[model samples]
Target: MGADTITRTNRVTALAPWLLVLPATMAVFALLAVPVGSTLAESFSNPLGVFENYRRFFASDYNRMVVLRSFWIAFATTAIALAAGFFAAYLIAGSGPRTKRILILLSVFPLLTGVVVRSFGWMVILGRNGILNNALIELGLINAPLSLLFNQGAVLVGMVYLFLPLMILSLVGVLETIDQDLYSAAESLGSSPFGVFRQVTFPLALPGMVVGSILVFTGSLATFVTPRLLGGERQMTLATLLHEKAIISFDWEAANTIATIMIVLTALSLVALGMLAKRLSPKGRA
Candidate 1:
């Protein structure tokens, strides 16, 4: 009887927090769940009131390529951002207080600005008459103007620029939490600065890098604003195609299918990251 009573008490304790969370949970169900359910339903629903949209996507090569490009672009963007952000984050982490603050501020400055404004900045920097081409011309580096805008190169640059902040912030959180003693110990044993970083700093920073890469990858995968503004016809990502399907072509079914694929990939990546972290945690502790 006493054990039953204690179980009841624990159940009530758990229920109390859930009761407080009920309203927020209800709102999430209404907002996120409803749209996602609708999309899932639509993905399996045919335009003619049957389930054919999904079949069509799987059957179409053009769509397969478009979706593949989206995933590829996102993967590439994430890798480059992670590589750059890791070094940048490490440099900032080892800096003094004031310098760290300045570096953090500089990292987030791009994120503070509006997306449209950033797109325009890319336009100015990569245009035919842009500063880079003009400087090259003046230096007699090339007789003809180099085309940088409206190409794969422009799309990648813009994607990396936009996604870099997420990487830096993710890395900063993990880097900040690391014990300085580890580095000191490594150095005391005669490890060079770069060697210490390679052995100690890099391993410790892996979790953050993994997290940041996932963020950048997901953002780049579903990227719409940056790619559309920066890329030409050859640079159409899955997101652009989805947008076109929904808005221009009025093909919501195709759009929903694309969205479903993106969601699945993102969820899988997060799950993979979780499993990886679990595997790595024990090694660090041991």
Candidate 2:
């Protein structure tokens, strides 16, 4: 080919991947970037000052409490899901083919149900005169039914139930990739089963744990349905507050401010988890 023709061919080859991805890029920019930009702009558009909305949020003790409570609940949910998921993943990873399939199906079955449905299920189990209370009353555990719903504990239970599958699936994908021979080799070297997990399995599973934790933590932070239903007005969370501001009160500025804060919190959490994952990785230790 002539030099000019060769140059044109080289340009097409170089641009091909971008050309293919152009549609997706445009879709993301339109759907995600535009809304985020608008929300951020609206958040700072308060008449009092640029930082007035943020200042207002911080100045209120109730707002501060809501933010702290949201973070605390998210952290607890992530931790519980990670521990439980790791155990379940390990069991599934070590099982025979048929058993592994069954275990995985069971782990994923909950995800097929709607979050609203699951939250309502929790309400049924936790409400006064509900299944648990009625069963306990029949068994003569208490003189009257104990209150179980509309609390922080109930919210935690709902959040954990909703996000636990994500953690399990993330860990299972990584755990299954690990060589079974590693466990055999560790045993051959006189390492206990627990030592094998600590030294080899856990180290290798760090990436999956990080992925799962991020999913669970971020989801727990942003979830509205479960928290709103289970926690009620007494246990207000940031997500519920944001909804109240935007939909109920029609305070766009406050809603946008909360949304911005949530984005920042979720981003910071991802960064912190990334750093922690690196620190725990075998390569980082080496």
Candidate 3:
């Protein structure tokens, strides 16, 4: 074979992998990059000016409050989900295969149901005239039903319920990967159960916790249905506000602005979580 031919063959072999991924890369660019770019462009192209939408977003106390509230809720949900998922995953990790399978199934079964269905189920449980209230009333717990639905607490409950399963699943994989010998060695070294978990298990599981936190935080920030249903008109997060602007008020410019802000915030948060995870991992520490 000619030297030129061999060089061309080598180039083609190197390019083959890129060619295989070209379609997927194009698909992502089309579906995500293009729309996001368009939205950002439209958000800046308002007749009034580029900064007008942003000024409006921060000028109002209500908008500021809503943005802060959204971050707070996302943080709270991520924390709760991680704590709950870690314990659940630890139990599953230590269990026999049959029990582990059953636990995993139960943990992830809610994911099979649609989000709308799950939100409605929460509505039934949390509504004032719903099942819990009715049962409480029947038991003479209170004369009048306490307002349970259409509030921040209700929204938090729904958010936690929605994201907890994802947290559990993320944690399970990490926990399962941990070596059993490590636990035995720790025990042999006279480490208590709590000490072993605190030093070994928890550190090893930090990556999974970070992954779960990223997922839950991002989802909680952008979730519309749960907040809309459970929080009603009282609480308006960024996602709901974006929906209102685009669909109800027909203000695409403002909607685009909010969307852009959300995208940036989500990206920043995920990056921070990734950095934190790396710092906490054994390899990162090393």
Best by TM-score: 2
Please list the C-alpha lDDT of all candidates, in the order they appear: 0.84, 0.92, 0.90
- Name the weakest run of 10 consecutive residues (lDDT summed) in model 2: 277-286
Top lDDT hit: 2
TM-score, prediction 1: 0.85
TM-score of each: 0.85, 0.90, 0.90
Query: Per-residue lDDT for 120-224 in model 2, tens only?
Result: 999999999789999999999987999898889999999999999999999999999999898899999999988998998888888888899999999999999
Q: Is 1 or 2 the stronger prediction by lDDT?
A: 2
Clashing pairs in 2: none
For residues 54-75, could you state the per-residue lDDT of candidate 1 as single tens digits?
6788798888877778878888
Task: List runs of model 1 lying over 4 Å from the truth.
Answer: 1-23, 47-51, 192-195, 280-286
lDDT of 2: 0.92
Give the per-residue Cα lDDT of candidate 1 at 1: 64
Clashing pairs in 1: 46-50
